[model samples]
Target: MSGPALPPDVIEIRGIRGFGRHGVFEHERADGQEFVVDVRLELDTRPAAASDDLADTVNYGVVAEQVHQAIESDPVDLIETLAQRIADLCLADRRVTATAVTIHKPSAPITVPFDDVVLTVQRRAGEST
Candidate 1:
């Protein structure tokens, strides 16, 4: 016999930008910077595909709003924390089985010139969700 089915559907949102005060440096916190966020949610889409009903699937628009709120809401010291928070928010929806969050800080307080600083966090349902 086959094992239990897995969540195979994926919803992705990328390059969500917002301004937030999140860092360890005094100036970093005082001078808020733009943050870019990306999120991916895994779930089962069969029901939605078959039913053709909005309620049967995860609404990406609502997910985007939630991600925006998480990014622009409170101030945290590290992007890791921010990523975790985003993951938690995504997993809050019972339809989602797993989620991955990537937070990018393009204008980080680093002397050396770099492209960007990014942190990615992934989580599954039933684990601190």
Candidate 2:
């Protein structure tokens, strides 16, 4: 067959925010905090596109659940770590060719009042390989 046609890969999930303790300060983990996550997944969906089957493509719902599970595991030292982990998970999906994971920490325990602390991480498939 001719070179596999480019797949239409698209995935976006927003809001799926959560409240938990993830920080370095002891008080942060003790009192807990809130966090928001926005994720986007990119991949070659040629198979799913042709088959029109969810099973043939990466599922955003499942991705969201996986992210939730990672953040809920326990308090993290830094948002960067969380971002990296989330990105890694996205890349784990065989169908996913690239991913962008952003973690928003509102009401961060900062001395000065700020809107929010956001961390964005982008990763592509086969990064480790």
Candidate 3:
């Protein structure tokens, strides 16, 4: 017989907006633009659920703050780097087993009209940092 099943819990935060200086162009880097970040943390929620305690699970509030800080912290040439930074931050919490991060640039310097430019990345625990 199979043992007790592990809880598959995910905490998601979407559409987190912040101003950042990130891009290849000097103008883009000099002048910051709005960036939207989305994060998903996958973990077992059984402990938190069973104990009804916030300490047992990832605190999404803190996650949001960390993500925002990461975005506003430094200047990067690629959204991929930003996404990786966010993913690292999410994985910092021991409770999180994996995470996916998406970054959106709505005001990319493109002559052609487009909704947004986005990049998404996922990382799992025990993976290379």
CA lDDT, every prediction? Answer: 0.90, 0.83, 0.92
**What lDDT is reached at residue 51 by model 2?**
98
Full ranking by TM-score? 3, 1, 2
What's model 2's TM-score?
0.87
lDDT per residue for candidate 3 within 14-81, as digits (tens), equals: 99999999999999889989999999999998899999999988989999999999889889999999
In angstroms, how far off is 9's CA in candidate 1?
1.2
- Candidate 1 Cα misplacement greater than 4 A, ranges: 1-7
In the range 23-129, model 2's lDDT, one tens digit per residue, is 99898888877788999898777788799999998888888898888777767799998888889988887878888889998878778968988889888888772
lDDT of 2: 0.83
Candidate 1 per-residue lDDT, tens place, 32-102, comes to 99999999999999999999999999999998988888878899999998899889888888999999899
Off by over 4 Å in 2: 1-8
Clashes of each: 0, 0, 0
For residue 45, give model 2's deviation from the true position in Å: 2.4
By TM-score, who's the top model here?
A: 3
List the candidates ranked by lDDT, beginning with the highest.
Answer: 3, 1, 2
List all candidate RMSDs to the true structure: 1.8, 2.9, 1.7
Clashing pairs in 3: none
